[model samples]
Target chain A: MSVDLDLIHRYRRSTLTRDELVKVELELQRSPAWRSALNDTVDAHRLGATWAAVEGSLDAPTPSRLERAATRLGAPQHLTRIMGATPNLRRAWMVSAVVLLLFGLAVSNGERETATIALFLSIAPLVPVFGVGLVYGPGADPAHEMATVTPMGGLRLVVLRTLMALLTSLVVVGIAAVLVEERSILIAAWLLPAVALSAATLAVSSFVPIRNAAAGVAAGWLTLVVIWARIADDGVAAFRLPGQLVAAVALAVSVAVIAARRDAFSRAVSTT
Target chain B: MRTEADDRALLARVSRGDRAAFDELYRAHAGWLTARLERRCGDPDLVDLAVQDTFVAVWKSAKKFRSQGDVGAWLWGIAIRRLIDQMRKRRPTPVEANVLFDQVASAEDELFVGGLHGELGESLRSLDPDLARVLVATAVDGLTTREAGQLLGIPQGTVKTRLLRARREARDELARLEGDSR
Candidate 1:
């Protein structure tokens, strides 16, 4: 019935029972001063700048979400750490792995005709290039800028992801190669082309947008294979020693170009 | 108030690997979790690490989250466990007394404690640390007495008693300061 200051304080502290709270609510409605006092008490306990400080700390660098997931799924601790340390590359790795599996399934057991197998292998090496394209540059990864500024930077990140894509593609293709009738030739053809195309894609990416570079390289390779098949009367000629020599030369040149312009990948070119 | 339905929807999206939804959940809970964890440990780095670990766990185990429970409380439980884990790895150095006092004073000022010459802030700073902490947990931090007890490792009744004493002391001090200022 009366305004007890201590009772009001207890009410403000939320230490009151349900009945007591109801009583205090009624009392508070009858007294503006009591309400003001309660507000003042609450204000005095304010955690100034604490929220902003915490929010800033949250923005501090940590492992990427995929890396954390990998760790949770029982990946090797060091491998997870490496994956976590590299941001904006998980999607590329995942896409590369999936592409390899699907491509391997399509070509395994010599189920398809020889022409179909040749065409598939010819295009299969480009799968990682596409994956690499999706990893960097504008319009690809939403976190491209963040990835660019990371301690790993763009060149190392691109290389790491490309290597991952290449390795996963190799393993999948290698397993599928064992199932094919012409295992040695198919492996040789695909392996050299995969490395050459991946390196060329990376090299071109340093100078142009990754998407454009990847598209250009893919189109040129496909056209060359088509032209070679027409002129030589053998579609698999592009997979032979002469073709492998060209690929080896392409790989070397691309590697040299990539090394010379390595700094180009350090800063992202915003296409948007 | 964040509804259980909203939390459930966000968590469901997170379980499906929606990064945006996980980000939304993080923004919603990171502040309060940081505040609560900081109360237990003075080390900012440790608190930050615990917050990070808690959200990472949430992202990984979101599918395990029941749709019917309080998401904030569940997050709190996880944050507390993370704090414990960090403490086990290395004990955090206690915050210096002067630094604590300065923080309380600065926070009071920053909140613009009302009354002539900000008597409320002065009064709050005048209370015993034990009483002030109880008040902060129950009032400012909006924890129930039982929750405050769980956080402070005290009985609920003790939290209630300390909270009462804290308020009484604050009221008397505020009155005295107001009377003096006038």
Candidate 2:
């Protein structure tokens, strides 16, 4: 079976119209052998063959696997576009509402123990802001149809959201810090770590699928807040960790997460 | 085996002994899978392995598929697990090599034998690392122009223009090398 290399090249160069592309694709697909060859090349690429290797391998290849694989890997989705566009606003809203409630409750209780309940309450606003960042974070899988063929760089989006989240968190945390006005090493330690954790959460969440990460993050944040609330009320400084341990983990994790963001974003863009 | 009740229906048949149905399901979803896996594993090879592993796992555990739920969602969950597993495996074992591989290789070695020596090597040596990177990503990596653009944060058209220029240069260089050899 012969493929029109000239046609393919022209199409790649954007000289072909949509109708012509469809026609070319149809023509190529019509020749079962050519279709099989194309499928094998794509498959080989998937299996870790660089194009040069695939080109080399094509000279003496078996044909059977390609036939079966081609049919197995070509079905198109109808709703992919629609689903990709609509953000999961409902989930975002739910998370925001819950966080706001937690923040309000912590502030209104007026309970002063050895651990400052109001102090912990001050950090609560960071939750929803961080949640937005996490959901739209460096590599988040927005549950929209635009997940497919998104022309924008995921890393660019991540950087934008991360800056927004950090800026928002810093401002709100600053307000909380001022309102309390009783600065201590303990509060300093808690605030910095918490802010960093918020960034870490965004990075980590991007490594997984979007909905799963969102649900997991929501649950995890709630649990942390509840635990903090309990500890704060009991006058226990449960937020504190050994300074060295915290520093080491933070440094190492920050590096790994930054590296993984590229990988995660690439994966999201490819599969979406 | 795949009598299109829904994607869910195809998945159910895949749970059965229906290879054809499974093939149908895979065909329907592989593009999306490729896109997602591409994000995690920048190397296309690793992406394919992760995807294949995902389908293989799905085939083995079809009985575990929950019929009342979203099939694509379940498959995607499995895909993420498979991808992470590959990542865990690919994580550098932290070898003690202070010098990278290229630094250790000698120019006189058989590795640079034949016409690949001299100008081709010199030309490559002369390229800026960023230009070399762009060239490798587009020419060698098989990423679409759009993907290459996104990765490099350039416009798709710019990626195309750059790639065309790179290819032309490579072609001219190769031709010159052959002419000189003759």
Candidate 3:
């Protein structure tokens, strides 16, 4: 007998008449395949429906409750220490401070030429690259296994560390830009490259080792800068409109890649 | 049918610590899980605990959820495993077979086994309890074989073998009843 998918659908929805229901039941009794199909349809429909009886028990732990649980269980201390001892943020700050100090000395000594400022800005985005690369990866994180087993594993962890690195680098570099004596356009030129290169590094790191990905990104970016400098007759020409446009497109593509491969970050791969 | 894309999107949001998405997922499947588990164990508290743990596990493992699979089947698999865990922990007093039979027969009397009286029910009652449990979980409860295995704390291959045996025995019993009637 040919099974009517529409009949099974209507029967599951309880839209069948008494006679229709009997007919369906007879068909179920006659054909095991039909019975199986009906069972699947019913199960699928019921599985999606809300059970009012258990609704009261489904509340997730709230922030206050989570805090209380953590305190009672002595879990907060470990998490607090981990957050406090983040080596990435510490190294990021140190690198940023040193870079800013060198730029400050150079500016104060009457050496704030366009080429020098552009060169410094080009290299500034690498601070976050190194910072994020240091924090991520199995080798970098002593608590990598523990963190991966937690609910906040995978993309969430990647986003958090990357955001911290990006923000730290941006703040330090933004301050350094303010100190530069160049035009505002030159001062803002580093922003796009910083975002694009950092995002691209993260996207690449999802598949490759974080350290290798960071190195490749840095090398490719610096090579582009040097080549542009030689070809454009101006050493600072890589920070121009065409470069900024390329950075914007690269940033968009990198973000897409990161989203598509977000789960890869959760895998236990060692960084070289 | 809820689209796979919709469930995948919800799971993606859930992985990101989205409370609203988690709540939506809970609302969607909690009741069905509770009902199926309640039927198995006959203890509301045990069923509730299992349902809660299932959602919690789902929240923690949302990142591992495969987008290509059926979300309901996946959620059902988790719920059954949680139910089994709860069963192992407390071992709720087993309802006697006759009493459980009466309860199920009365509840689903007209809906599932209509017109046949107790033929299907009796066939179910006569099978080995383990095989019967697997059969009910899959055929009656509407869970897939994989899900039934997860719920029963057995391997998928075992679920398949037991299910095939259970179906053969049930069909034989029904045929015998038909022969006797004729």
Best by DockQ: 1
Q: Which sections of candidate 2 miss by over 4 Å? A: A1-102, A105-108, A118-130, A133-151, A181-183, A214-236, A241-248, A269-272, B1-182
Worst 10 residues of 2 chain B by lDDT: B93-102
CAPRI classification of candidate 3: incorrect
Please give, for residues B1-182, the per-residue lDDT of candidate 2 as tens digits: 22224777788887886877766666655544555444334455555666777777776788798777756556656665565466556732122211111122233222322222333233443343334335544543335676555444457787777766666777777789899999
Q: Who wins the lDDT comparison?
A: 3
Candidate 1 off by > 4 Å: A1-65, A69-113, A143-154, A164-185, A229-234, A266-272, B1-83, B92-182
**Rank by lDDT, descending?**
3, 1, 2
Which candidate, 2 or 3, has the higher DockQ?
3
Clashing pairs in 1: none
Q: In the order shown, what is each candidate's alpha-carbon RMSD?
A: 13.4, 22.4, 19.0
> Against the true structure, what is model 1's DockQ?
0.04
Instruction: Show pairs that collide, candidate 3.
Output: A51-B31
TM-score of 3: 0.40
Q: Report the C-alpha lDDT of model 3 over B52-142, residue by residue, as the tens digit.
A: 7788788778998887876766776787678767876886545342111223332233353333334445555456566766766675546
> Candidate 1 on A1-272: residue-level lDDT in tens?
34467755665443433333334433333333444344344321232243344345546567668677877898876566654554356456566656665665565545545675676567667767776666545665566676678776667777876786677567666665565555444555778888999999989887788778888998999999889988998867798889999999999999999999988887534443
Report model 2's chain A TM-score: 0.46
In order of DockQ, best first, we have 1, 3, 2
lDDT of 1 by residue, B99-122 (tens): 122233323333432231233234
